[model samples]
Target: MPVMPVDRRTLLKAGGALAAVTIAGCTDSPSGHASPSAPPGPDVAVAPDWAGFGRGLDGRLYRPGGSGYAAAHQLFNPRFDSVQPGGVVKAASIADIRESVLFARKNRLTCVPKAGGHSYVGASSIANGLMVDIGNLRSMSYANGVLTVGAGARLYDVHAFLDRYGRSLPTGTCPTVGVAGLALGGGMGVHTRAYGLTGDRIMSMQVVTADGVFRPCSPTQNADLFWALRGGGGGNLGIVTSFRLSTIPGGKLGLFILKWTQSQAAAVIRGWQRFAREAPTSSWANLHLDARSDGTIAVRAVGVSTTGSATAAAAQLESFIGIRASSRSFSQKSHLEAVRFLGGGTSSPRTGFTAGSDVLRGPMDASTISALVGAVKARAGAGMTASAILDPLGGQAAKVPTGGSAWPWRSSLGVIQWYVGLAAHPTAASYNSARSWITSGHRAVAKASAGGYVNYVEPGRAIQSYYASSFARLKTVKRKYDPANVFHTPYSIS
Candidate 1:
């Protein structure tokens, strides 16, 4: 869902990614969005045509050059840095979200809502259009083990809040990721195999449709929209205001990491194709290999299991990989600690990168494995880091029948991600090179992968890869919810 942002994915269910920063300098507003004492001059984008749009809301608005505009305008992926919104409405409440939708109709301008700003391909942004930022709409409550998360709540907020109650949800690793965005796209995480995806745990949501109406959706209420909301891509059907998610009790966890040299990488990967796919639902494993500038392939196998002790997890690891690991370590940690570690809590990870991933029915063929290793080494020689991962998707997640949700990829054994690094603020040369490498890497993986992950979206990809057989059904719901093409982006349900 959040793609669990970091230099690589933080390992979703660990929690998810961060917001991007820019060099543009602007003073922060002295007041928060919920405060009503704020001035109004800069709230309307300084246009007579925009004044009513601002007055119709209880939140603050930022024009291109308004105070806090620079801070609020940054997207998670800088690939679309050229696409600047005409204005950003920091919605203060559900009412503000409804007003923004109606305002978009009156102005005849495209309006996109942004929460947590982590769309992998900048899907939440639009060029010269209105952006309804729900950053200020964060207010939450938990009753009877159900967390009613605000549309604007981040993964960090959810984790911290749930930690207080010893409850957890399978989600992306990045802490700053928007809860609504992740669940909307059918979130996956280490806990997914056992507890199911973030969306799977969702009991209900508050959505603002194209008609500017706020309504509650669930299996029994607004059923069609609820079906679409479970796995329909974000900003596609309607603006979700709140999510009532069922949480699982969390406790101490056993974490395992096994590392091997390049010579052993293949054997480990070969074993991964078999064992990782079959690991216990309470146990999830991932394999990571990076092409280092030193021309060496760095391979590591990591996992978390809720069903066993550290020693038991280690023994399970031994059986998982028949070959002895060159280095192995195991630790006992609280769920929050382990989640943070997997999500990359210690880095300046919010930077630019090109990511291409694939959904596979099974493990990679022998040739694809060789090609992947070769590709990594080749990219490393080019001074670009090529990182790939084999993330398992079975366990409880596979129990949901195909078409049970809009995600429609229950047959997937796992996903393979190949991403090339670019500078936080990359040069044309660096960006182009990373794009080239990712393209080449993507092609190699496509030999086995039938589709791509929606959360880690790539530019210009067909919707079939992400939604598969669910695309047509998704389209029907999209048309019903947004017949005027109000909630749309480049790859939106069309």
Candidate 2:
């Protein structure tokens, strides 16, 4: 899980206060590196003059010292405190991406593809070498109930593009996250329990391979590559420029937010586990924990019901927990509004923060919950906020058989995103303790379920282990598509 430090407050009092922070900004260096700055490794090959090729393709060339170099290297994850890449190619179309790839191949330089630049691990936007920024390739075409979007598109853009048609696709809750990385990594969201992951809706992909060849991949063509792209992780294959997604009819949804205290956490968790097993496919719920400076813990339960009947959904949810909500915000809104709600609204701050995630398929005992609450409560005084979010995963996500796609964790019950925030400088003692708390929670959760989501990988875990039983098959696919490991990144296929 990507662990980020957040400010703490009781769930009841924190809702409106925390929702005001806006999460949109550029994460770039003050002095952009427009020139070919050498990487730390020994010099091996010289980069080609892609400026000429870039000019020919998109009429946009960002060489070292260029005016657009600074804007091209910015990303959504501000925590990545690295210098901008040596050069950036801002692609306006698929042809531009192809030309950039061919130039990189000829120059024998490593190429990094960037979309929304929201990757917390620095996988989407690299610090050096050739960088292809696809942020401008934001075209969306919908025909025959299918929507084809450029890989550079963001979730909010897609939502707005499809809103006119009264259609929607399965995507993450975060509006700023890139559609490319989210879909490729088995996207989970508030609507996931009803529509499956974003990858499940993919009909085909347009990608530029390591050899500079652009091709379409789907079940009928380049099947192996298509399967690998589903959940095998991005940057481990070729550069995906566009995705054809299956569209679903958009409708009203019932959204609910309930809160409880630390003393009731154990009971709430146990009750939630039982509720998930019996909850209808149209209903999805997630538990969020927030720490308070006074050593108090607040638990917030956010849920959505596709059936659009808040009263009925509330009855089903209340069967497990007996706490009457002090406040209830229930509404029948459009898919985009639901996105705005579950995504924590558009006002969330976009400051740099560390985040970690995990996937759970079995039960998390009451003792485990108590221990986690205790640890987080203790750390809240130090300005660290911990959150454990549970997302249901048994709808269309489980209907797809195991091994059917590169995403191996098909049998999981849900995903648990254990997050903590770092506001100030990270001291060794504080860092180590935070890491230990996260690690301990993972171990405790793993004891019940060893499977983990590739998108939510933590530090020190083996890449193969994260895949669990599907590692062997993934290795074969990785070898076939990326034999030279040219697309390799941290925790991806070697």
Candidate 3:
């Protein structure tokens, strides 16, 4: 039931800190052959001039047979390798993005924006559609206390850049995750409690709407669109070129990692819930219940303290659990060091997994915890690797007013992510097992769950679950900005 003396390697993998991005690229056609054309739609008959389209752009375009096309279409998740786009434009500037959007609209082609290509459901990629790769738009600058970064910048690069000026922004720990996707879907991480969410720091944004019109969004400009962009899921309204956000001073941060046996899972969970809800805003922790391949559970707590000694933070956690950790480590680190440490030590890209989430309204009951534990154990017993990671949403995160942004989970206790590692070539049976386990997880927490997080979206669930009460307003925004539904995905507000 419990695993003792859990090592760091096992913990990182289980918690997805080491989840890498896979870049296998497209294999739809043989090498040297032309890319397959999408079946014609009812309204379109003539093919657009590919060479002519490429000539007018400042950025380069990649077709099926063009160099770099494969890499341009690659996504973080390997499962989407087969979904190849008809064309990929590496937009170099705002003008390039506007031109791409206008081109897609003129040709009535489906166009998807690719910031970091980390869409959990592969929404960033499209089958036989045009994919706009904004990876070349990365540009960063710091002025006064505001950090203006291109939407295409990855977390690690952003962190490293900010560290140079002794500044930091609230963002996810995954180094390869894109700033646009993470911030748009309501970023939650080590700095969340201490600094609120990444989006909360946003001062303004440069976005290219569905009409190919470039608009500046902020509290004072395009106010409605700005509110929607804060927590509104990406690929819904438009493509964000860059963002201007307020930054906090960077300095030494106290970090702690504590491990507990699964035998104390119940007490540790209950305690963590209370501690997360009551802890000082300067202190934050995430509880990870990771299932190893050997069919044992690894229980751990990893967090940071923006205020005092991490040793004190560790002791406070013990008091709540009513027991001491089996082992613990405490260290003080510079902002960049902490970012790398919490990011699982490396940013090497590789990927093969399926994940989803449930937002907890409060501490789960004993029965629900038992059910969750049982589901994990059962799935592991069947030879599937799984993990449940819970990140708290209290503190300043909840202080945002209801209408402040589209993110409706301000009052949530935390978000529980159900993650399952997939094989290089997963079988149907493996998918079935994973689906079953996730279903059980949803059923177990159904009573205490407010809904699901948009960032950890899954298939087959109602879109309303992500936005809750704000869904209606989001739809209204959608209608106003994208009445033609140009930027649409399976879970878009429309």
TM-score of each: 0.89, 0.87, 0.91
Ranking by lDDT: 3, 1, 2
Go through the candidates in order and give each one's C-alpha lDDT: 0.69, 0.64, 0.74
lDDT of 1 by residue, 1-494 (tens): 22543212553222233312110000010001111111112244434467666777788888887788776777665544556687888889888888888877555567687886766566677666778998776787877889888889877678878888888888866666778787887777767787877888888889999889888998888888888888776788889999888888878888777778888777778877776576667777777787777767788777778874555655665666677777777777887786666655522235456666677877788898888777777887776566777777877777763225787767787877666556555676766676677677777777787787777666646767788888888889888878877776665676
The reply for model 1, stretches above 4 Å from the true place, is: 5-8, 11-48, 78-81, 346-349, 401-403
Between candidates 1 and 3, which one is better according to lDDT? 3
Cα lDDT for residue 202, candidate 1: 82
Q: Model 2, which residues run further than 4 Å from truth?
A: 1-17, 20-47, 50-56, 63-65, 344-349, 381-383, 401-403, 424-434
lDDT of 3: 0.74
* Deviation in Å, model 2, residue 408 alpha carbon: 1.3
Clashes of each: 12, 28, 5
Position 219, candidate 3: lDDT: 82
